[model samples]
Target chain A: MFKNFFPNKILSLSNNLLNSLLVYLILVMFLGLIYSLYISPPDYIQGDSVRIMYVHVPSSFISLACFGIIGIASILNLVFKIKFIPLMSKSLAPVGCTFTLISIVTGSLWGKPTWGTWWAWDARLTSMVILLLFYFGYIFVWKFVSSFNKANKISSIIAIIGLLNLPVIKYSVDWWNTLHQPSSITLTSAPTIHYSMLIPLIIMLAGMIIYLLIIFLMKYKTETIKFKMNKIKNKK
Target chain B: MLGKNAKKRAILLTLLLLLSAVTIFLIFKSLEENIVYFFTPSEIYNKQNISFNKTIRVGGLVKENSISKEQNSVKFIITDFKNEIIVSYSGLIPNLFSEGKGVIAEGELKDKKYFIAEKILAKHDENYMPPEVTKALEKSNK
Candidate 1:
């Protein structure tokens, strides 16, 4: 069943695709770094410290998106009993965890210059910490649970429960009087940020997303190889 | 096999429903208790029984021309545009702290009208623009 889902041809194609993506990722990252660090204008209030937003915003966004992917994949695995979906979630968990950590760290750095404190127990910050814990819990289940079937079910349920925190994290600023400012760019309204800063931010976001794709593809490939090896051992 | 699948689905659905229900109840309860990160000046005014000893944060805009620097302490009026509270702080303020900018002062309320801030934090809005653009906007507003 796993072999059917990830055939040799598909694996080879993914290898080629990963090579092309790597090239693109390098080029985009170079441009993104240049634009965010030098080309972007300093904020009227924050000056150079505002550059941290280029990294902080993208990491936060990617962390949230990765969890969303994990949650949906877990639900599908549970409902349809898709044998390969667990592999995808397993590959994604670490990437999400790393990005969540990056977001928290960069946010703290940014907070010091702007909010005048290294950390605050504001709703947005606290909820993000909760999200990080959820990611840890999800990864922990997969690591400690030795049985494959039990690990899959337990991790999926953990991912699903973590999904509940996403909305809370997104809405925490608006719902509560957090030190973190409300989102400038919302789906419902025009962005309040100026074009000069917005361009670099978008570029950085694109670069980080490409980086995430690269990492995820590499991890998925490794997991697939491991899965095949396990199956062969079972047959032996 | 179909019965087993149905049973699994039912269990998963019940779990999701129960989890969400509990989450909603907790959120509502927290809201009722008002777990606010910071209270606005207007909110402080609206509170029925105000505490004096407890350290709380009051966030608002620094009223233009309301800043008065003394030898050791700086005094400013924080206004939510509805009500205002006088704040005096001796500590070093954040770089972004200025007239007409948002700020949050953490300290005990001496009274309904006065706040003695132990720490002062600058609160910037979400708007990010170049210095020139800000200057132009400020100029145009005047």
Candidate 2:
């Protein structure tokens, strides 16, 4: 049933989805900001600084999520010889890198007011730093290697290799004793967060994901078009 | 019986996989010791021949009314239900540091009973005080 899913139909669907998603994203982001800035109660201990969680948490989540998509695309490329997967993975690196950077910066801003330091060599923070380096190394391979096949082969390897770090990053808090607290939200149980705080957090998470989707789709479309144009030019 | 190009690709893929496997193995092997950043009070208490003045971390909730301010330092007790350790620190505590809150103190163990903290880390939840801390404090009170 899924065999006839052609590229043209998928592209058009993505376009329509992208338009609505953008509008929805903007509206949701606005509402989320309102709740984060005004509605949520100040933390009993950390006070207003806890509001930084709205940005810091979502950015870090999206950063890891971007790498996850890249890893999946790399796996498909490696196993199934999918032509566009490498480019899609390439498109995601910058988005992942940018969000990783945001996560670190916002985390530092949050840390200063709460942890009394801008940076710590704690496990979570260090693992995130390593993730950022992996993103950079992946992007570096794509840019420095001019041959398409060469870039694809090496970049995919980097993406696949980086997969080992994801589990480490996710489990770092539980497996290690670091300044970073263990995650309160778990898959098997109810979250420890209050509904008032969780609502805005969920909204912001949705907004960030939609934003990532918009950027990733745009990058994918551009790369696909560029490949098609080059092919046509080469034929002439 | 593979084509020449397929043979090369397979070799390259295998090499990459092997390289990544070795890299990950080395990283985790080297990091094994540093992985566990802090120990609970119970974990510390159960250890034998523990040297004093060597730095370590013990994590638990700050026992209520255990904090006493002195001219140069502040002292408090951290407990993990079955065990407790006193921590002394001269520096300013983080904003999140409070009685009945989860904390991890890093410093030399003067003994199992006292921790001269070089640093004190008080953990806070996304919304409020973390639940495990409340549970620990309650358990100790009982």
Cα-based RMSD of the predictions, in order? 2.7, 4.6
CA shift of B133, model 2, Å: 17
TM-score of each: 0.93, 0.84
* TM-score of model 1 (CA atoms): 0.93
For residues B1-142, write the lDDT of model 2, one tens digit per residue.
6667656766776687778878876887788657766788888888887768677778888999999999989999999889999889998788788888888788999878888998877766534533445567679999
Measured with C-alpha atoms, the lDDT of residue B24 in candidate 1 is 74
For TM-score, the strongest prediction is 1
- Model 1 steric clash pairs: none
lDDT of 2 by residue, A70-104 (tens): 98778667766767678678878888899999999
Q: Per-residue error at B132 for model 2, in Å? A: 20
